[model samples]
Structures are given as C-alpha cells and as structure tokens.
Target chain A: MQQDAARLKVTREGDIVQVEFTSRKILDEGNIAEIGDQLSVLVEAEHRPRLIISFAGVDHLSSAALGTLITINNKVKNRDGQLRLCNISPQIYEVFLITKLNTLFHIYPTVKEALESLRSGSQAGRLK
Target chain B: MKHLKLQAGPRGQRQSREKSVGLWCTEEFPSEMSEGRRVEEKILSQCRKHAYGQRDLFALKLALEEAISNAIRHGNKCTPGKNVRVKYRITRQRVDVMVEDEGHGFDPAVLPDPTADENLQRTCGRGVLLMRAYMNNVVFSPAGNSVTLTKFNESSSSSDTPLSTTTVAFG
Candidate 1:
C-alpha cells in the first residue's frame, strides 16, 4: 500500500497566507513536517506569516499530520501571523477530535469565514 | 522468560495487568493503507483497555503504520508478486510490532534525512524518523528488509503522555 500521494500549494493575500493540501490521506509520516517546514521557510524568508489551510481535499489525517499542522501554527504565531484552517471533511474532523488537535487550532466551516476572521482581530485565536 | 514489569502513567501505581489476550494477522502487498492503520489503532486500544494508556499509543500507532507502509511500498515496491508480513506481540510490559518485506534490503545509514533542507518538501523519508520517535526502540534486520518496533506500556520513561483527546475552529 502506498500512502504517498498528496499535493501542497501556498498562496498569499495581503497579510494572510493560504496553504492548500489536496490528498486522500495526509497520515503518512514526514509528510506533515515536510510541508509544514516548507511553509515556515517561506514565512521566515518572505515575511508572509499569516496562513490559512484548506482541508477540503483531505479525507484522512494522523497524529503526525496533526503535529505538522501544530508546528505550522506555532511558526506563524511566532512571526506575528495566524494559521487558520477551513473546509475540513467530516471524517477528518473526527480525526481532529480523536487526536484532540481540534482544540489547539482554529477551524472554520468555510474559507470565507477564515479569511474574514483574519481581517478582524476580535477573534481570540489568532496568534498575532 | 523473565517478566519485566513497568508502569504506564506517572508511576507504576496506576498499572493493571491483563491475563491473556493475543490477536495477530498478516497479508500480501498493495492492500489498502488505511485498513492497516485502522487495524493498528484497534489493536492498541484493546491493549490499552487491558493495560493503562502509555500516552505513546498514538505515536506508536503512527510509527507502526509508517513501517508497514515502507514495507509494502519500498520493500515490496508495491509489486503484486511480493508480500509484506506483519506480526503483533503483546506482553505485560509492552507491545511489539514487526513489518517485513520480501525485497533485498536497503542500507539504513544511507537513507537521507527527511528533515534536511533539500528534502523538506518531499513526501517520503520521514517514516524511519517517525518510527524511531514514536517507539522505544526501532531495530532492523541485517538485510534491512525487516523492522521491529517496541513501545512500552508506561509513560514515566519520558514525561510525554496522551494530551487532550478538544476542538479548534478556523474562522
């Protein structure tokens, strides 16, 4: 069994950076770290810290993937930017619950809501 | 066999042992990867009920999945002609898992670090690192075709345990 087909994309809008992960399963090891570290390097080098993750394409995630997301969250936070997630599949939502990462990161039902939250600082979750 | 006793939580104080429970299975290569992960989780949860939570169950499960994935992918190379073997062992103090492949083994030392600058964005190479991190010990055979992993049933060897098992919204 090959648990190895996932694609990642990074884009930025104003101060907010959007990261899109498209895969059937992101549970494979080093997958999260590899993608998360790439995003961190971008933030560190380009100074575009704000990040929004779209999980619409992901159906499965594991502890390692959760760890990677946490690392990305922390990286953006340290740089005075925020990491937000949107459009998580219900199955993957169960993954967040199982791993209890759902409590640590901010997840929205839609991309628009996540973007709006970044524009308004009233939300308590953003790192900045 | 000299029974080695260990605790799972803060100290041995919270430990409880089960008398006898054994479950094992094996299959050929190219089977669904998600099914393998689900099997691992089920085994660990059942073991946890008999014993206490090691807090490392999640990590161990992930490690086991990586090892098996490697065996079926790199070892068997996803060739339908080849087979990957999976074995499960549970004792009072720990749980052991072995994933073996039919291919000629590769060198572990030569394996590139997945965290390296050049390899950071790659999807592979993190399996070994994760296997080592999640389990107490990760061992490979002389041929490197097989990897063995053992996870202690206790949490005191290190301070890491299961954290909030909570929800976070994005917007």
Candidate 2:
C-alpha cells in the first residue's frame, strides 16, 4: 500500500511491533475500519504478536475508535499476544477513563515504557 | 422558529435561570461519514465562534460524532439515499444538539452498559455511554429515531441523571 494510504506507521523489532497512528483523530468510521484491518493483519501474521500502539500527536477520538481498539485487544489475546498502548494525551486519556476502558487496555506513558513492559512481561497500566 | 424545552437545567435539576439569546442551525446530510464530518465541522465552528473552550469543544465533538454515526449506521443501516438531520442551538451557557435518522426508531432504554465486566470487551455499544458521560443531558425522542444532546460550556461534569428517559421532541 502507498505510504499516504497507510493509517499506521508499523515497524518490527524482533518479536515486537511498534505502531504509530498517522491520523490525529481516529473518529472517522472509514479510518477506524482501516486501522482495525491493518492491525489485525499484523497481529495475525505473528505466532504471539507483541504490539505497542502509540497515541502520540492524536488530538480527538470517538467511541468508534475505542471499539476498534477493543477489537484489536481481543485479537491479540485470542492469539496469546501482548498489546501495549502509550503516549495518550490527557484529553484522550480522559475518554478512556470515562468509559472505564483504561482497565481493559495496557496503557503506558511512553513508548520506552511500553516496550519495556512488552519485553519484561510485567506490564502495568494506569493514567498518571 | 423551532422551539424545544428540557425538563432539567444545565446544572441538573429544573431551575430557573435568565434566558439568553442564541444562534441556531438545522441541517441535513447524506448517510456518509464524510457528510457527518461536514456536520461536525459546521457545529464546532459555531461553538468556536461563541468562545467555547477546548474542553467543551472536545466533549461536543465526541458526542456529535457518536450521535451522527449511530444514526447513520444503526438507524439507517448504512444505506445510501438516507439522511441524518441535525439541529442545534448555541447560547452563552450551553449548546443543545439533536440528530435524527430516517429509519424506524428503537427503545434507547435496553442498551447494555458497556462498562459491565462482560461487556467491557465488546467491540460496540459504547457510543451512548460516552455521549451521556460528556454531555449534561442526553435524551431520545419518543419514537427513538432522534437524540438530543446538551452541554454547558466551562461547566463541570453533571451528577444529575437524565430527567426522563427518552424525553425529547423530534418532528
């Protein structure tokens, strides 16, 4: 796929895949669907996908986006994979908290921290 | 001029406050996410004109997008040729928005709480929950084809429950 058409910037490091959002707002239904598909493909390709999705530069997101994240989490779990999320803005973090989704997803403050947890198998997540 | 009333005030319970002049707009768009974006931008532009803070804008943006998308997907079944109608009024204190779809309405009362442990992992069903959380008032029409959302600018989140379930006028 062309770089401009890609909704995520994905790279692999050993068993870990670091993903970054290309769109600031993950609210658009089309974009959310595409993001879900892309992530699904990546997760399915691995025996046990270790993925970290960074929310850096994301401004606004809707519940639809949250639903997409939930879908990704389920897929990773079904395959016995690990998923970590990091770099969430305060406003966006509040969305997760309001819906009580902060408990469901492994969220961290920085990509380094998320990468560490994915590697250490001691993932702890909460909004600070 | 269309007029609508809410049983509960911005601060929750029915209270009397000085009414202020407001700017209002009513529009219709095709059942497409792009059209939904147009509606969102139009409304957010209005909110910005009235000096709505970033926090208020974020809440409104989230609620409006969810409401519009629900109407398009769930209500219209993602079929083309159908339309979503939006009407909102912005005042100094608050903004009230209504979204209606052409499809038959369903009861809004039976929606499962997405926060439940079992439902937490569900891929859908969180739209209405977020709308209720961010907006001070969220009401459905008697027929359930429409939703009315209200948010008070620069106001803290409300602890008041909805005055009445499915209590909005949609014509």
Candidate 3:
C-alpha cells in the first residue's frame, strides 16, 4: 500500500545535466525503469559531457536502482562523458559496497566536488 | 540432520531434503527487498556448511534474491491482499529456490533484453538475465506464476540425482 513518494528533478546549466532523485525507497521496477528512461533522454541531449546525480533525499536503493545507475554509466561512457554521483547516504553507500559498485562509479561528497572533478578532468578524491 | 516431509505437493518438493526456510508475505511491493534478503540469508547459512565455498554461494544468493524480488514486486503487482511464497531446498549437491506469487502469469520470452542498447539504461528487466547467469537451472511454471531456480553445489556428490526428476511435476 506504500506509494512511491519520490520525485526526480532534471536541470541543465551550460553543458552539465543535473539530476536529483528524491525518494523514500528506490525499489519498484516501474519507478526504476521510469528513472532510466528519463536519464537516457538527458544523456542524449547535446552539450552535456557531465551528468551529476544528487541523492540527497533517497533513503534506500534496490538492485534495480543500482542496475539503472550501471546502465546510465554505460551510456555516459559510450559518449566519453562522465556520470558523477553526490550526496549518497551512509546506508545507500553501504549497498554500493556490498555490490562492489562503489568502485565502478564516480561518487563525490557534494555536487560541487563532482562538477569540479568532471570539469577539471581531475581524479581527486575518487571513490574506492 | 532432521528433515520434515511436507505434504506431497509444491511445498514438499522444495522442503523435503533438509532444514528448509520458507517465507510467506502479502503481495506488497515495498517488502520485496526485505523478503528477498531474508531468504538469501537463510540460503547462505545453509549453503555455507557444505563445500560450495564463497564464490558459488555468493552467486546463488544473488540469484535467489533477484528471483524473489521479481515474484513479489512484478508478478504480484504489490497487491497486499494476496500472498507471495518463497521456499528453499538444500541437498548435498544442489540448492533449489522457488518463489511463487498469487497472480496470473506472463510470457517471460517477451521481456526486453536488459543488455540491449536501448534497455541498458532501463532499471527493470535485468532480474531474469541475472538469474539465468548465476543459477544453473531456471524453470518457470507453465503459467509463469512461479520460478524455481537450481544451483549446483561444487562439492556435491557426482552421483546425486536431481530432485525434480524424483518428484511429480505440477502445472
């Protein structure tokens, strides 16, 4: 009976695409698929070599969410672009470790850091 | 070392071999991960005592969780009024995990490939592929209402027979 109480915000500044996901739980397949569809649109748009994903409001992430992230990562990589994740909670961060995905993506402590890293093409404070 | 012979039915086929684990949940979507994790832990605990080691156990655990989540969330449509049933069977050579939902069935062959270029960014539809990669035998009921996954334990006796062959098949 619990509905998806989350919303995704998409914005673009210059060549950077910023996506913010606010959700209580990112578990449902439909919701995850929707996020993927929206992300693909943003990824295909012009002038965006950088993608910033802010998970400021997400409480937990399921495997489906992780899969979506991986899928997006692949898309971004194919274009020689970057997908940077910021504001990951401790709980969700642990999930990344359990799946060994933390090592596969660019995760930063804040949006500024992610944007700066992508903009500068520097590997500073990379996620292990 | 004791075994409980459940009635000669679906439940018995999955629980007859050893100390099995069963989870019954209302068809609520949000509980999918928790239910999946519960069964995953039970399976890990049971598989650990055998010779499967960490590598095979890890793959089996992931497959089991994915299958359970699919059954509860997609198949059941999160209808809390219905029920999702999960069961596990651990023998010396193989581990069998089954997840059944209280809903009509669908065609698994029609699902989009998760690895396709268009679907790579999609969040769903990866469960079936992942299950197939990790589990040795993946069988769906004719109606598509349930999935039974079997993982062969590496340390299993070579001469052991498949449980499914010994048990009666039901639609």
Candidate 4:
C-alpha cells in the first residue's frame, strides 16, 4: 500500500511499510493533523501491518506529533502489528528521552537496521 | 509566583555600549488550530532574527506551539467566536511568551502525568509535559486562563543571571 500527502510519503517494501516525513518541521497543527490522518488511513487499510516511520528530513517535532505517534502505535499494536521509528535527529531524540517514549517504541538509528531487525523475526528485544 | 520584569539589556551591564534589543508583539486569533500555528511561526521568525541557536530555537518553537495550541483548543474550546491572545517579548538573552484564552481556566496540578506507566500510551496530556520540559520556566495565572513561558538563550552570556531576582514589568 502506497500513500502520499503534502508532508508525508508512504511506500511499502514487502510487508514493511515505510512512511517518510518530508517536512523539515512537523510542528504545524494542520500538517500534524494531516499526517495523523494519513497514518490512520494506513492502519485502517491493514494492507501491510509492519511500519517504519523515517524522520530523516524532519528537524523538529512537537508534542502533537508525539500524540499522533502514540495513537498510531496503539492502532497497529491492537492488530498484532509492529511500528518502528528510525533516523530521529538528536534534538527529537532528546524529547523521546524526556517523555520516556524511547522505551515505548522501537527506535533505530537507520532505516536498514530497523528493517533488518523486523525481517529477522527478532521480536524478543525489538518490541517497545 | 516569580514575576519577570522586562529589562532592556544584559543584567548589571546597563552602562555597557552593547545595549539589549527588546521586541514586543501581541496577536489575537480565532480559536482555530491553523491560526494558532501561524502565530507560532511568526514568533519563531522573530526569535531567529535575534540569533537564537538551533537547539534553543527548536525548543522554543515546540513549546510555543504546544502552549498556543492548548490555549486555542482547550481553553477556548475551539469556539468559532472565541479568540486566543498571545503576547511575547524577545530580548537578547531570553524570550518571554504569554498565551491567554477567553474561557475558564483549569488547574494544571490536576493534569495526569503522561510519563507514568498507566498513562504512557495516552495520545493527549503530553503537551504540558513538553512545554515544561523545553522551557526554562512555565507559570500559570491564578485563574489558569493565562500561561507564561520563559526560555533563556544558552549561548547568551547573561543567561547565568538569576531569574527570580531580575523580574521587570513590561508596559
């Protein structure tokens, strides 16, 4: 399943779907809502259960984005699916640490690593 | 409550040739999310003009967004006719931002902790946490209708000054 939005680009690589945020800053309220809607659509579609959200181009993320992520994570988990995040910048990384969200989701330093781990069936330490 | 008096320059350097630059802007927007975001962008543009570093800029930007959004969504209840008031002061060393909504305020102490085990998965309640985490000081009026956030520029030499003793009122 592939989807596109003004600020997000989604493509599926086998069972692992990758959603890349193209915006430099994801702090705008309208943009945040649109991104959330797109992700929710993906979750409801149920085409590919596994997801990897790439934040390579994102420079800033507000609490609204964090909330959206939590909503999407819960949606995926409810269906026995997995959600992973990769390429989070140091600034955003600090926020995850502050909120202790670093422990709630599987975060990887690179997209390749996240995809590899999910494909290898390494679910022991990868969840949360 | 620690009152921040708006000072014109670096503390205790009033005689120095390097004077402080102060900027004040107040804007009123309808209780719409997009309008709140526009105000946040405008404030961030001004902060960048004052030469805020990348990390500090990002932090302030996030905090401001959360504050303004809360004022519009929660305080104003997104009522079409209701408006949110945003007032901000930018100095060489710090930025003071205040957001007020035209509604009854709620107590901040009653808010649930988003970081707790039971609340960890909650989609909301994290905005206040983010604001407190990123800003130097976060204060609410007795009525809770207004919130003030202060963030000191880490790269500025005057950032070491004590915040409680240097309070100055702005016109």
A33-123 per-residue lDDT for model 4 (tens digits): 8889888988878854898999987888878888889999999998889898998888888889889898898998888888987898664
Stretch of 10 with least lDDT, candidate 4 chain B:
B9-18
Candidate 3 local lDDT, A1-128, one digit each (tens): 11222366777666787888766544343367778887887787744358898988776455677888888898888888888998887766755655556677789988888888988999797676
lDDT per residue for candidate 3 within B46-76, as digits (tens), equals 7787667655765675677677777777877
TM-score value, chain A, candidate 3: 0.86
Candidate 2 residue pairs that clash: none
Clashing pairs in 4: B4-B168, B5-B167, B5-B168, B5-B169, B6-B168
lDDT of each: 0.64, 0.82, 0.69, 0.82
Task: Return the clash pairs for model 3, or none.
Answer: none
Write the residue-wise lDDT of candidate 4 on B48-164 in tens digits. 887788888888888888898888889989899999999998865679999999989989999998999888888888888889999999999999999999998776555433233
Interface RMSD of each: 8.2, 1.2, 6.2, 1.1
Top model number, TM-score: 4
Candidate 2 chain B least-lDDT 10 residues = B157-166
lDDT value, residue A4 of candidate 2: 37
Ranking by TM-score: 4, 2, 3, 1
Q: Which candidate wins on lDDT?
A: 2
Best-to-worst order by lDDT is 2, 4, 3, 1
On residues B27-122, what C-alpha lDDT tens digit does candidate 1 reach at each position?
A: 444444555566666667766764545345656666777787777667877777776777776654566788888889988989887555565534
- For candidate 1, the TM-score of chain A alone versus the native chain A is 0.79
Runs off by more than 4 Å, candidate 2: A1-5, A124-128, B1-19, B155-171
